[model samples]
Target: MYDEFTIAAYERNGFAVIPALFSAEELEEIERQLEAHLRLDLASAPKGDVVFEADSERSLRCLFRIHERSVFFDQLMRDSRLIQLVRQLFNGADVIADGTMLIDKAPLTTYEFPWHQDNAYQFWNPPDAVAVTLALDDSTAESGAIVCLAGSHRESILPHQPSGVFGASRSLVTPPNADEYPPVTLSLKPGDVSLHHVSTIHRTGPNHTSKHRRNLGFAYHTSRSVCDNAAADQYKRDLEKFLQTQ
Candidate 1:
């Protein structure tokens, strides 16, 4: 369960870890259900460089195609405990945009997620609220767990991205202001969770260990106050329909 402190931490830091939210056995089972499908998806993607970990024997990515694989993820997607949290944090009026098992942060030495926020996304009460990162495995700094800037989200909506060019997972910290952005490492084990605000500046680096640290990132949102820009409302009328065409 979460509390005022937990919510406040998330508000101030844009992220906070919730301890032991899933059983090890449950995680193991979920991974078992996801591994094969993920591997197959990775092998078939037209662009390998964009998705797979920069330098690791990573398998599949399910987030891109979760709606189609209903059998494997349907019940989990409909999880009441998860949905309840979304409603509580976003204060209801939210919906599940999408999700899938993000597997094998391929423990090696070269995987990292670039700094970015889902805030640009229009599916929620406002991306500024929060999203969920449910750990399916033990998450640690060395294992390529999430690292977040304390409260960058409340400031500028500037893209937390790199300049010059793109390469690997990058931090948005820049000169003269890098010190202004302090990042904290979140350590969590299976069953534990972390709530990251949309504007929460965050990223992950490659796993330096020999074992894969698999985690599932469950992204959520509430009906945004912004005007519906073209396909926005239409897409919500049928998330699956819109996705199938993609």
Candidate 2:
């Protein structure tokens, strides 16, 4: 459950870290489920939905549309506690999940996620959206944990350019005064979670340590936030093209 201070921190800083969102045993079961999914042939996965890090066949870069692929992920998205958090964040408004992703940052790999805002990629009309990343492994700065610019969501969405990585976008570190905003690294243990607004500027470095970093991320949008259908469709086409080349 979200306390008043937690909600206020999220409102003021555009993000908050919640410890023990899941228990250790629950995390173990989730990892087991994910490993079962991973054992399947890549060709069996929906095209353009799963991605890998460059030249690393075993390094899962991202898995999109996870709720559609697995009942476990779908249940996670619909959990009562998660629903309550979403409603609380959005002032009791109805919430719907727009996307879910599983990201893996392989150990000792250079897989940097460029700084960008979530809404910049989708460009929702009212931009009322939230994202949560639940750490499946102990995430540290050395293992590519996410770092966000505190309170950056208060500013308008910044310009983003295609980063040549499928479905990935990058932003300049100048406009929001990245130096002034001060980055907050979200170091989380297994079952810990971090939540951020749609327009929060965030990124992570490569995993330089020996431990693999894995997280399940979900994006939720309030009923009041509407996506630009045309842009969304066009993005899908572009994403398809990019994935085909990978």
Candidate 3:
């Protein structure tokens, strides 16, 4: 549960970390189910509706439309605690999960997620959504835990260019300018969860340590937020093409 101080922190900084919100057992189940789902995704993706990362076929970058892929993820997105916190963030407005992603940073991986805003990729209107990153593995600074700007969401949407990651399109990337916002590391233990506004500037560094940095991410938006179907579709098509290159 969040206290007044925590709520104020979220309101002011556009991000907050709720520690140990989930139990260790729950985190284990999530990781187990995710591995199973990812195996299925890798085996039947592209030819099937599932998607993979842009660079490596074996890396398993993210599982999109995750709610439809498995009941566990569906339940997670609909979990009472998640909904309650999201509603509080949205000022009691009804919320819906617009998207879900399973991000994996393999041990000693060099994947660099340049600082960017979630809204830059999703292109949702009103940009009033919160993303929850639930750590399935211990995320430490050495293991490439996510770094965020304290209150960058309060600023206007900065200019975003193409990431040049082969399959990534202009809309798919927003490389961060580090000088604009101060960065703060959000180290998390398994079962810990961190939430950030859609427009909050954030990024994950490379995994220098020998531990997998796996996280289940959910994007929750109020029912009042509008979707740009055309933009979303284009991104999907671009992503699909990107996967084929791998």
Q: Encode model 2's per-residue lDDT on 18-49: one tens digit a residue.
A: 89989888888888888887676355778677
Best by lDDT: 2
The digit string of per-residue lDDT tens for model 3 on 44-102 reads 65453433454554665555567876787888888898888988888888898765677
Model 3 regions more than 4 Å off = 47-57, 166-180, 238-246
- Give the alpha-carbon lDDT of every model: 0.60, 0.82, 0.77
lDDT of 2: 0.82
Of 2 and 3, the candidate ranking higher by lDDT: 2
CA deviation > 4 Å runs, candidate 1: 39-50, 53-63, 101-103, 120-125, 160-178, 225-246
10 residues in a row with least lDDT, candidate 3: 164-173
Q: What are the TM-scores, per candidate, against the unseen true structure?
A: 0.73, 0.93, 0.86
Q: Rate residue 125 of model 2 by lDDT.
A: 72
Instruction: Find the 10 residues in a row with the least total lDDT in model 2.
Output: 166-175
The residue pairs that clash in candidate 3, if any, are none
Residue 136, model 1: Cα distance from true site in angstroms: 2.4
Q: Is candidate 1 or candidate 2 better by lDDT?
A: 2
Sorted on TM-score, best first, the list reads 2, 3, 1
Q: What is the lDDT of residue 122 in candidate 2?
A: 72
